[model samples]
Target: MKDWDYGELFEAINESYEEFLANGRGEKFAVARAFNEYANMGKIEDIITGVAIGEILASHDKVFIGYIEGITGWLSEVGKKDLKNELSDGEIENLLGRIATVIRDLRNKPIDSNPVA
Candidate 1:
């Protein structure tokens, strides 16, 4: 993909994130509008940032999806149990800690993946 695509994705992610933060942290219409705006912008750098942010967010989303699937699978195998007997407080804390570490690592990864500037 083009470098500018990353910028646009990043900007869209940021705009969505901003709306989430401002609007009680749930999906909303404004976030979607922001995404549309970012997609329509033609500047390469803008799009590149959007792509960078989107990549990071997408990675995190994937990780979370995996985690959820794993947890659900485990619970189902164990007779569809809920948190009441599944995870201890320590285990929950550890899982959250690992997620936080992942987020930090993703944030630190270089945005420029292209060979040419």
Candidate 2:
């Protein structure tokens, strides 16, 4: 297994987040479509390639809703009202965490030493 570059991962996450904001309702859909295209060509990291599919497979809105509830609680406790949205920032953030975890976990999986390209 190779060491993962945390900085690079963070940068990717930032880029993805910007994409989400730009696309709004189609955010995850867009990421999933792009990720799948790359994964099919073996051009993306495995964990990232799997995220959207994971949510789709889980098939439960509540799981995602819980994420929002948790975030709302934190914001309320701190008196930061703006971060607490009805849609659940915590849930979306949880998805982000899942994305991060998958990438980190992929770093431990056996992979071809050569770049996919």
Candidate 3:
């Protein structure tokens, strides 16, 4: 039920990205790690984490389809839903659009509103 600030989330993601780069990890892995960390923190729900990951992947032109599948599989494993089944192959644009709609819907909701409600 804690309200999340996207600014703080982005800052954390950026820091993680820098750290991952310093350690020779790729951007995709960094993003995945950040998503996992934030989701596991219990402040952000799985759907929000998925949306964040979708947005990050969409922004990166070099992201491979395998990365998307890996993230979707990870989300499915952790969120306990078959999100990978929900996504169609080569539909990254559609996926990003859906994530954007979710983000907009979240923005319209009250800060105290239950995301899972």
lDDT of each: 0.40, 0.39, 0.51
Q: Which stretches of candidate 2 lie over 4 Å from their true place?
A: 1-7, 37-44, 51-117
Question: Could you tell me which residue pairs clash in candidate 3?
Answer: none
Model 1 over residues 21-107: C-alpha lDDT tens digits?
577643333333444555544433332333333333434422333323432333223211222233455643543443444445444
Error of 2 at 76 (Å): 35
**lDDT accuracy of residue 52 in candidate 1:** 35
- Per-residue lDDT of model 2, residues 19-93, tens digit only: 654776554454444444434422123333345433332332223333233323322233224223421455446
Off by over 4 Å in 1: 1-16, 25-31, 43-46, 49-53, 59-117
Local accuracy of candidate 3 as per-residue lDDT tens digits, 13-105? 656655765676666567656766766655234554666665565555445545455455544434223334433443434444555554444
Q: Please give the ranking of all candidate structures by lDDT, highest first, separated by commas.
A: 3, 1, 2
In angstroms, the error of model 2 at 40 is 4.7
Q: What's the CA RMSD for each of the models?
A: 17.9, 16.0, 14.2
Superior candidate under lDDT, 2 versus 3: 3
Q: In candidate 1, how many Å is residue 99 off?
A: 22
Name the top TM-score candidate. Answer: 3
